[model samples]
Target: MENVAILVDGAFFIKRALHIFGKLTPDELASKLCSYSEKHLARDRKGERNKLYRIFFYDCPPLQNKVFHPYHQQQIDMAKSERSIWRLQFHDELRKKRKMALRLGRIDDINVTWRINYDKIKKLCSGRLKWHDLKEEDFSMDVKQKGVDMRIGIDITSLALKKQVTQIVLISGDSDFVPAAKFARREGIDFILDPMWAPIKEDLYEHIDGLRSTFPKPCNKKKLESSY
Candidate 1:
């Protein structure tokens, strides 16, 4: 049986989950992630499953500091913020899951700043909205994630060199993993990319053994619910 190692880009997964799975609690989100990873283990026609070596999840911890919000005209304590709490709880849930490795990076808080929302900036550029008309929702904290891609690359190289798994499934939409994917394929590992229905770059097609997405489409929420 093929031994599979699933690597997840946590931020990408969370953003896509909001669009595909809708709103779910942190615990529910973590459980759904595990369930999603299990789908990769399914083999052809006969009801067979592959051996799961492990799930490596890469993400940066939420920023934990007080930053002034220009739109809100107040200081926001990110450490006690809703997103921070949710992320911490989600990480904890992942830790309790079996055969899961939570690999965390760090936030570049020193260079952190509030960025104007894309839509708001577009409106301003098109003369549809004025600068003074921007509301609190028009701005969001820009937290730069550092070390995540590096950590992912390191883990993939380690797994391939150590012969820990015969297959590697990366669930991310970014093209940053091309080098790692190429290396894994050269090592005789079946590298697969699961963008979860998101479109990937055309150049990415040549570096992987196969492309497969093992989740319900956004339009098929009912099927996803039934699976659980």
Candidate 2:
């Protein structure tokens, strides 16, 4: 049986899981995640599944301090925020899982600011946009995940070179891992990407061995309720 390393992008999973499973608390998400990993990402080509070498979950600690969201014109207090509290609890939940390695990255909050997309701003000025005008993505908080990408790259390289596992499955939509994926495949690792049904860049197709999403797309509220 091929040994698999399940690497998850915590932020990506959290945001998407909320859409899939309505109102998922951190504790609930952790339970669902473990079940999902075992069922989906840990399988070999012959359809026989094995326990993971380690489930590597990468995320930064939640901001426990207060910060300002300039566009929303409000002081977001992480210390008192429900989401922040949930995130920290979520990390604890992951930590307690056997063979689950929670790889942490640092969050940079020093110069966080609201950054408006220039293209969107220009369109608004020229009256060419309406559907997405005033949307949240049009203006985003420019906070950086300082070491997440670097850590992921290093881990992938180390795993490949050390022959840590025969199969490497990364659950991320970020194309930044293309290089790492390519390198892993070159080292004769079965590199798979589980974008969790998210759309990825066209170029990312070339680097990975295969695409396999464990989670099917979540149905609408009515369909979900009817199934039950």
Candidate 3:
């Protein structure tokens, strides 16, 4: 019997689920996720039950400040509420640090004789860097600085090297995982990519052995409400 390990990107999954199914209560969402997992397991090898391995959910806690968009805030709120309900061990990445870096300048003071550099630095300190002040190329510079991809990759590789499980199921749509998937495949482990309720990427199909989407069905409102 092959053991199947499930690695869930909590942030990605929650956002996808909420986007697909309206706003669901924490318990309702957790139940739906479990159901989705069961379906994925049953779909493999003619309903033969695979050994249930540990389910690892990776995500950073919401910024202590609710600075994210409204939808994102809802997702993060649901995740916090669901942690205890689902017995999910939350693994926090440095999301706040990344956010800070994106908003703040990266380089230390470079001595410049130009008045423009001094003026720019003063404006930055005064919180005057508006959207118009930035150039098109600077859009990329606003990306979150934390490397969630690197963290996920390291864990996947470490588990593969340790021979912790026979198969790995990763729940994320981020293409950044392509290399990690390749590495897992090289180790002769089955790499399944489950994008929870997100549109499937055709290019990713070739890399993964199995694909599953966890879209919530039209659930009864009363039942969902009580589960919370």
- Residue 124 of model 2 has an lDDT of 77
lDDT of 3 by residue, 1-228 (tens): 577777766656766666667666655666566567655554356666786566655654332221232222232333344433432332222122111111111211122111223455577778987535744222111124244666678778977888887888888988888888899899988898878646677898888888766555434343121111
lDDT of 1 by residue, 136-210 (tens): 666667778999999999999999999999999999999999999999999999999999998899989999999
Which candidate would rank higher by lDDT, 1 or 3? 1
Q: Residues 1-228, candidate 2, lDDT per residue (tens digit)?
A: 878888898878776676678677677889888888876545558877674888888888866667876556677787666666788888899888888888888878786667677887788788998644476546655557778888889989999999988888898899989888889999999988888887899888889989988876876553121010
RMSD of 1: 4.1
Better of 1 and 3 by TM-score: 1
**Each candidate's lDDT (Cα)?**
0.88, 0.78, 0.57
Best by lDDT: 1
Superposition TM-score, candidate 1 onto the true structure: 0.92
lDDT of model number 2:
0.78
Q: In model 3, which residue pairs have backbone atoms overlapping below 3 Å? A: none
Rate residue 53 of model 1 by lDDT.
96
List candidate 1 stretches off by more than 4 Å: 44-47, 220-228
Candidate 3 vs. true structure, TM-score: 0.57
